[model samples]
Each structure stands twice: as C-alpha cells, then as structure tokens.
Target chain A: MKAKKSGGNSLFSVTAILLILLVWQIVCSAGLVSPYLLPSPVDVVKAFISDLPLLIQNARITLIEAFVGLGLGIVIGFVFAMMMDRFEPLYKAFYPLIVLTQTIPTVAIAPLLVLWFGYEMTPKVLLIILATFFPIAVSMLDGFRSADRDTIRLLESMGASGWQIFRHVKFPGALPQFFASLRISVSYAIVTAVVAEWLGGFGGLGVYMTRVRKSFSFDKMFAVIFLISALSLLLMKLVEVIQKACMPWTKTQ
Target chain B: MADLSIRDVSFSYGETQILKDVSLHLKDQELVSLLGESGGGKTTLFHVIAGVLRPDRGQVLLNGQDITGESGHVSYMLQKDLLLPYRTIIDNVCLPLLLAGMKKKEARAKAAPNFADFGLAGTELQYPHQLSGGMRQRAALLRTYMFSLSREGSPVAALLDEPFSALDTLTRQEMHRWYLGMMEKIRLSTLFITHDIDEAILLSDRICLLTGRPGTISEEIVIERPKSKRDGFAVTEEFLEYKKRILKGLKRT
Candidate 1:
C-alpha cells in the first residue's frame, strides 16, 4: 500500500515536470523568449546528446572530487561529533564556532582556497569539504545528544565503559541523522566542487560550464545544468538505498 | 545471587532536592518495587542506585560492598525498550556481552539460547521495530538480564523503572504474567519502580512507598502470599487490603 501511494505521488511529479517542459518548448518555439538566453527543452536535449561524451568526461572529474571530499567530510564530522559528545568543555567551546563556520558563504571562501592551493584539485576538494562537513557534524551531534537518557543510564548500570556506551548506543542512535545529513552533504559536495572549479581549474563540469557560458552556448549550458541536477538526485537516491540497508528496522513499520 | 541496598541516599540538583533519606533493600532473588507518583523521585533514586548519579549522602551496597557512584554493578531497564534500531534482536540483546569485551561470535552464541526462554526465538534476526510492543519489552528485559550476568555464575541485581508502563492494558497484563514466570526461573534480584499500586501488588514481594516533595520511603509493605498464589490475586481481598494501606501511606506523606 505504501509503495503504491509513493508510486502515485511520483507519477504526479513526473506529469507536473512534463507540463512545465511543454510550456517552455511552446514559449521558445513562438520566440516569446530569446533562445540565446533560455533554450527550449528540445534544444537542451539536442545539446545534451551531442556533447554527452564531453559532459561524461567532465562529470567524472567533478564526481571524483565530490566523492573524495565528501568521504573526508563525513570522517571529520563523525570525529568532531564524537569528541563534542565525550567532552563537555569541548562541546561548549566549539559548538558555537561550528555553527559560525556555516555562516561563511562558500562562494566567499572559494577564492581564498583557490589562492592558497592554486587551480588544482586540492582547492576544489577543500571547498567541497567546507561545504559538506557542517551539516553532517551538526546533525550527528544532535542525534547523539537526543539519545534516550534512560538508555544511557541503563548501559552505565551494566558497567559499560565510555567507549562501549558510544559504540553500542550513541553511534547507532546517530545513524538516521547521519544519513539525513549525508543526503544534504552529498548535494553540497557536488555543487561546491563545481563552484570551486568555476574559479580556476583545468577540468570538471564547472569548468566546462564556464567555457560554454563564455562562448554563449546557452543550450549547452542548460544541458550541463540538467546533468548536475540529475547527478545530485542520483547521489541522493544512493544515500537513501544505503540508509535502508543500514536501518532495516525503519522499513518494518 | 545478588543483594542490593541503598542506604540513606539523598540527592539534589542544585537547590531542588529530588530525594531525601531514601533507603531500600533487595535481598538475593527478591523482587521489590518502589511505588510512587510522578515527581516523587523514584527515577532519581534509581539513577543513584544505578550509580549514574552520585547521591549527596549515603551509599549503594551490593553484596555488602560499597559501590556508590559506581556503574555496571546492576542491570537497569527504563520504561522505553530502547532497542537499537540499526541492530537485529539478537545483536541488541547481546550488547552488554559485547560491551564486556566478549567476542562477537561468542556473544551471539551466548545470547541465542536465551531468546527462546524470553519468547523471542524466531525474532533473533528481526529488527526491534518489527516486533510488537510486548516482544520489544521482552527483548529489552532479556538485554537487561544479560547485563546482570556475572563471571562468577551469579547474576547482579536489576533496576527496572516502569518497564511495562508503555504497553496497552492487555499486553501489560500478559507481560506481567510472563515476567513473573521468568523471575521464578532466573531468580534475579530486582528493584522495580512503578506508580501503579496494582502492578506493585501483583509482581513485587515487597512494596516501598516513595512519596513527598523530597522523596523518602514512607512505608514498606511485604506481600505474604506465595508466588504461585499471586495469579489473579489482584482482585482478591488481600490485594485490596494492601492497596488501601499503601494509599493511606501515600496520603500520610
């Protein structure tokens, strides 16, 4: 029954998307919008099919950067969360600073990163990490804090060590929130990599995008945008799959 | 196998005293209930007994040895089942063994046999969310029991705080019967807390009335009826007499 309901919802979503595409195509065909600025859906598709090879090549580079950075971000986030949970003073001292880091615009920091590390993959990966880690760390910390007090007390009564308590309770308890943050961080990772590449880079989807925009190949630009969105959606879907595998209890209900 | 005594334990969170001069005892293989209303510090006393929280005064003794502010001496079960959502039922029950540094395969082997005794044999591979409320509680009880098992072939005492209050009326009654049977077989010493007078009368060998602003043991009533005769005893005149006495004790406080 649940599957059927979700299937119906997805059908509606697909219909709505198709309707918007039809309207866009009509507008472009009637010359209501300049093709140079807003290419029709058909034009974008043509551009996509023609430049598929190039797009795939650039996408691979961006994906590599995104994956590497996101993996590191998750590790860093998990460590930070564990430390904050274990030490009261560290939680009090660094929680505000962690929040503050999120407020600094990734765009503003991207240039500095590029300047420091040059136009290499390091700056791009760093930017992605900076963009990705906050959500993972904050959400995981919240998950850890929200663990049932009674449950912790129970473990303590059993004479569980601090590490045992964390391994059995806090880490497992934080999983749902960790996955939630991972979904957000996954998209942030891809987008941040692209943004970083725009400033200066030899390869990647963002670099490709800049080149296309400069040449006024708007259709190609639109195609790349669609590709980026598709990639983000795919990554989010992967996260969901992994989440289901990790938390089978959630599926029983 | 275990004897637990809380001696004149007083606890306060700053100026707000939660417990004052609280003393209770559970003889080996005995079941004692701390009966009280909400905000009467039943839980506060449990925390002190569990050694998660230090009492401002007095000590917690197990087997005549001081264990005040020391954890892992007893098994503590809270109202919520608190089974880890990410783990299977067997794994959840094996947590204490794992925390005690038992090997994973050995822990599984140890916990496997007890599943059938707890009415959870087929549920070993299932997740917590897949089980009924009663089953989850049973699993939690089994987990608590595992925690109480000592290397000397003697089990430690268990501290249960309203362990079945979350279930529906029918399920709670079923659990009560099952719990009584299990207690007889296991011979575990227990310090249980409950607000329900009938529950205390039905399950406990003795009931300690904890009441007042800063909770104290107002009365200790021993149920003289044999364990075998307690089936359907809740509706008996003897049960009513005990209930009336407890109610009067609460009122006096």
Candidate 2:
C-alpha cells in the first residue's frame, strides 16, 4: 500500500503544491497579513520569471565553485590515502589533523579566507574544498586499510611487488568508497560554496541574495531561495546516478 | 626438497601463547589439515606460516630456503571471501596477476581460463554482490589461487583457515569436494584448518590437533590412505574410526 501511494503521489505531487498556493492566495486576500510582508505566490512567480536569466548566471558561478572543489577534493583524498597506506607514521600524524579540519566550521573559517585572499573565487573555492575533503579522505582511508589481506598474501607469494599489491588489491577495493565520498562531498561542496559566497564574495547567488534583501525584494528573494533548493536537489540526484553507473554492485544496497 | 617445513614454531600475543612448539613437514602435492575446536591456534598457525604474524621462535622453510619472516612465500585464505565489491568478478580473480605488474587487460585475460573451471563462466561481468554465496566463494578462491600462484614467485604453500566454514552445510561439502578434485590437476602443499573433525579427516593427509584457551598443538595424526585411493564417498572405515579418536582427543585437551 505504501508503494502504491508513493507511486501515485509522485505523479500528482505538483497538484498538491498548486492547492497550497490557492489556499495561500485566499489567506492573503482575507487580509490576515500585510502585502509588503507576505506577497502572493503569483508575485513570487512573476519575480522568478523576470529574474530567470540572471539567476542562471549566478547559479553557474556557484556550481563552478562547488564542482571544482568537489573534484579537487576527490583527487587529493585518493592520493592522500595512497600515501597514508604506504606510511603508517604519516597516516597517524596527519589523520588527526584532517579530523581537526572538519571540527572547525567552514563558516567560521570563510571570513578568514576572505581576509587572506580577498573577495575573489579563491576563498569560496577553498571553503568548499575544506568542507568536502574530510569525508572523502576518511572514507577512502578506511577502504584502503581494510583491503583484502588474503589477496595481498596471495600476491606476495606469487612474487608480486608492493606496488602491485596496492594497485590490484587496495585500489580496486577503495573505488566504491571513493565514489560514495564523492557524492557526499558534492552536496557538502554546494553548501560550503553558498556560505562562502554569503560572507565575502560577489556575483554568485549568495551575493544576489544579499542584493535582493537590501532592495527589499521579498518575492525575488523567495524565487532565489527556490532556485538554490532546486539546484542542490538536482546535483544530489546526479551524484546518485553517477554512483549507479560507476559501481552497479552498490545498487543492491 | 619438500614444499614446506616448520620447526619448533612458537608465537604469542603479548602474555598469551598462541602456537606452542608446533612443527610440521609437508611434501609437494600433499593436502594436510589442522583440526581443532574453534578459537584453537589453527588460524594463528596459518597466520604465522603466512608471515602475517611473527612467531616468537620458529623456522619456516619453503623449497629448501628459509621463509621465516618472509612476507611473500605462502598464500593465505581466510574465512571471509573478501571480494572487492566495487570490481567485477573477473577483476577480482585477476588480482594477484595485476599485483605482479601485469597490465589490467592482461591480468584479466590470464584469468579467463579458470572462470569456466569452477562453474563461473558467464558471471565475470557481475560484481561480487550479484553472485550467489557459493559463487562468490568460488570467485574468491579463484582470485586467491590466481593471485598466489600465477605470479612470477609462485606460493609454495596454501594456508586455508576455515575457508569453507562460513558456507551452508551442503555448500561447504560441495566446495570441499571441488577443492579436492582440483588438487589432482595443480598440486601444492596445503595446510587447512577447520573446526569439523570430519572435514579435517576428509581433506588432509595429516592433521594437527590444537587445544584452545591459550591454544597449543596437542596432537598430530597422519591420515594413512594412499593418494590413489582417496574419494568423496565418505565410506572409508579408517576415516570413521579416527574421527572418534580425534573428538575424544579434543575433549581431553
């Protein structure tokens, strides 16, 4: 029964939103709140249509920041894991430092980055990387460490070198976790990018949001809010798709 | 030279001794079993001989050379399949070859012959989770064997620590039968550990009986059936007679 409801509701979910809007318009007409404080859904819709091109342009900047950070974080994480796998002392020394990076909120660190690097893309990108790097590094490190001991023995007995064991047994084992972290980091990257932009950056949706607030454009602000949510949800779904395509075995889970 | 030999091997985990003055001599083309209760030092011995754990005092020789503390002489297979869920079955099977510095395509090609050897011909493209439990075990075995023996430095001995213990009763028996059958084609010295007295009796030409709780080797029994006479019928009177004695010995220990 739950499956049936989910399927049916998914098809008609848009209708539910329309009904809510209709009720919202009725309440506004009934004068329960002032128009300046609470605009009708139609006003928000109008603002959204007019703001479409600029919103897309601003969204592009945020997407770039997020994607670049996520990509760099993934590459760096895998490389760091490999290094750690090779050197135990290095892993022991740096792992706690990596953990420490995550404990310090990116929000608190972003303004410092802005102070150091100014209001260019660097601060936003750095913030996103710091946020995304932790999960990827930790997940991939665990994956590397837990590689099949049996397989490693077999390789060594076969005269396989150390490099060979890692390439064959360890790296292959780490791929699933790598992509899982990638998905997590991608979502985190988006959030960090937005935060970085809000504090000290220009031209992204965050900056546009501050502009909309200053001009007292509440309808436009609502429209911007909707776009941000839509973009985030879409990026998360894209990651899910990539996970399926790259590692189909996880589909069972 | 015999395929493997161990002499006065002793190991401990901090204050607790694991293998107590254990010694064994094995010839090429022989399958030996180590039978004991669960938590006995059978696994500890396997790990010791595989060079995973250093024995406090011992000498291990492979093909007339000292392999004590050697990390790459004998292959080890444990209870868990340890298949890389991210990789396809074919890749898993080719792992040892890959570890030996073979190109990715070449490693997989080398494994093509054995996929059909164990009733796994069509499932190479499938991932570990997609295969049945029995099939995954087979794939894991194939991978272990290929990785250990196919490389330039072939493993002198195969150390199995309850490799089939996790399977259902019927599947475990079937795997045992299959493993025995394969022994005729590619013979190697083997040390198998199992909690089941019947399994040790059936698989090994010699059994090292271990007593748990600060585990120690308490008895060594030689299986006396001629190599030409071994079969899966389970009808051998000697095997049955010894089973009673082994169980009594374990109880006494």
Which has the greatest DockQ?
1
Q: Per-prediction TM-score, please?
A: 0.91, 0.86
For model 2, the stretches where C-alpha displacement exceeds 4 angstroms are: A1-19, A29-31, A75-112, A139-184, A199-202, B152-155, B211-220, B231-233, B245-253
Ten-residue stretch with the least lDDT total in model 2 chain B: B147-156
Interface RMSD values, listed in order for every candidate: 1.6, 3.3
Chain A in model 2: its TM-score?
Answer: 0.86
lDDT of 2 by residue, B69-131 (tens): 776677667688777776789987877666556788988887898888877999988888888
Under the 3 Å rule for N, CA and C atoms, how many clashes does model 2 have? 2
Model 1 RMSD vs true structure: 2.6
Error of 2 at A12 (Å): 8.0
Among the numbered candidates, top TM-score falls to 1
Residue range A1-253, candidate 2, lDDT tens digits:
7779999987798889888899989888888878778888888889999999999999999999988888888778777888888999999999999998889978888989999999989888888878887888899889889987666765565566778778667776787787777767777887788888888687898888888988889889988888888887788789788867866767655
Kindly provide the TM-score of model 2 when superposed on the true structure, using C-alpha atoms.
0.86
TM-score of model 1 vs. true structure: 0.91
Q: Local error of candidate 2 at A189, Å?
A: 3.2
What are the per-candidate TM-scores when only chain A is compared?
0.98, 0.86
